[model samples]
Target: MQTEHDSTYISFSREEWASLHPSSQINLTQSEINHIQGLIGNLTNEEISKIYLPLIEYLSINMEAAKFSHHVKNQFLKKATKNPPFIIGIAGSVAVGKSTTSRILQSLLLDLPARPKVDLITTDGFLFSNNVLKAKGLSERKGFPESYNIRALIDFLSAVKSGEPCVQAPVYSHLYYDIVPGQYHQVCQPDIVIIEGINVLQTPKQVGSSIPSRVVSDFFDISIYVDADESHILKWYVERFKLLKKTAFTKPESYFKRFAELSDVEAEGVATDIWNRINKVNLEENILPTKYRADLIIEKSSNHQVDNIRVRKN
Candidate 1:
């Protein structure tokens, strides 16, 4: 019930957000939901029905409006303006469910009546390689703004926005914690492209040049910021770290293999250290500052449930 009239977005509690689309059907099965959710757990089919179904409906309406806008522009130009892909940027801190949200949205959008071609691209793939980072002495700041090849990421987005038939993006492997050599993700004529990352909503740093500045988010038709209290994010990061230690970190070739044998207490300490030293710093310096830039801000509870929704008034 609390809100600011001057704020760009009007806030709504989770219950109110769900009530906005009471007729939204849960087309996704439990198995499907399971596959879409990332490391953070505690998701149920009912939660998906209440939270994401309404979100999908809201996005569908927006997408249709975007198409109509393109149509009108093309009409005024007296020429066919090729329909470019509708790009949605999802940004948040580590373990904040950006991947899960992107994957679920991709699935739901594809099932729409038009059956739009939805492509999900994570900005992790755009990170500089470990070798490159090492060469630049930036290994410790891997997820920081300067650690990414922002130019290349912007170029890839520009290509997609230009309605290019096919574009390739570099691939980064979480297992090795580095970019895979000679590997690229091919995005071919997608009707919608979801760009998920910690820094997708970030603005370009001033380079003190006369060159026109362009941010990665300039291409987005809609942008979402997954938000949660810093305490919740820290807890989620620690929990996911423990889960990975039991799972992926145990693999011999995993970059984090050394932590695999850590005792629960030791693992928790490492997780906390990582959060305080790197993730939290990055969140405060780069990620959270961009929350207001999003068209939608989805606030999550400590249990990984959507607690509320805020939509930009304009």
Candidate 2:
């Protein structure tokens, strides 16, 4: 039986979901188990189980629906036909846990009974290099839509949808805070492609218009936006910054190595300042505006649990 999370939609909670399939268990690989254990400090196993299991189930169902839809569309074209890959776009604000969500979904979706080959591609790879952004005088607008190679991203997606044998996408290195030249991820024909980013659903800027036009979302078969209050997201960002400073920033090659020596107070202040100056402004001016366009919205509370979900009606 389906349970309504709200008046308009029906979905199961983690506990309820667990009860439904007594014989089935979520089998995690050793590395995946370790990853979940690490997150145990901030999230409970039950929470992860409940939030993600259902999400994976939903994605599997949707992926099949997408495949069927593609097949039906192709039936009309006869022998000249090829179905495009189903593209799922995920968007959210910084520190809203969208990255974790994307990764989890990618793993879970691959484990489905359909056993569809899945590929995870992040839009971060499409971001212009620091030098390019600096030359264009847009370095400070790092996560802004204009900071990416929109056409290149679109071309990559188009190739993937067309079932190209091999497609290469540039890689972005968070440690170095730059695009690593000559390093790319090759994606073969995948049943589904998950594209995650800060502004995946945004409309591209028109060629000559003052505002940016939309590029990628136009190709998505389904889209999700991770949502939370601005204040809550800000706090999460600050906490994550502190955590990363204590860990990743200590690496000599890290772009934020200088942050490792900061006092807690100084680090908090710096994180707050960056949030205010860059992330917050970009969320307001670009990201949030596209929320309504999402097929589904996952709303999280300050504690990072998804308390509610909004699914658009057919």
Best by TM-score: 1
lDDT of 2 by residue, 1-314 (tens): 54432444444443555555444446556676556434322555565566677666666678778767777777776554566778889999988877777777777777777787888898999999999999999999999988999889989988898789999999999999999999999998888889999988888576665544437988898899999999999998888788888998999999999999998899999999999999999999999998878888888887777777667775
Global CA lDDT computed for model 1: 0.89
- On the 0 to 100 scale, the lDDT of residue 119 in model 1 is 90
User: Against the hidden reference, what TM-scores do the models get?
Assistant: 0.96, 0.88
lDDT of 1 by residue, 104-216 (tens): 78887888898888998999888888888999998889899888888899999999999788999998899999899999999998999999999988876865564438989
The C-alpha stretches of model 1 lying farther than 4 A from their native spots are 1-6, 27-29, 208-212
Worst 10 residues of 2 by lDDT: 36-45
Clashing residue pairs found in predicted model 2: 14-50, 203-213, 203-214, 204-212, 204-213, 204-214, 205-212, 205-213
Model 1 steric clash pairs: none
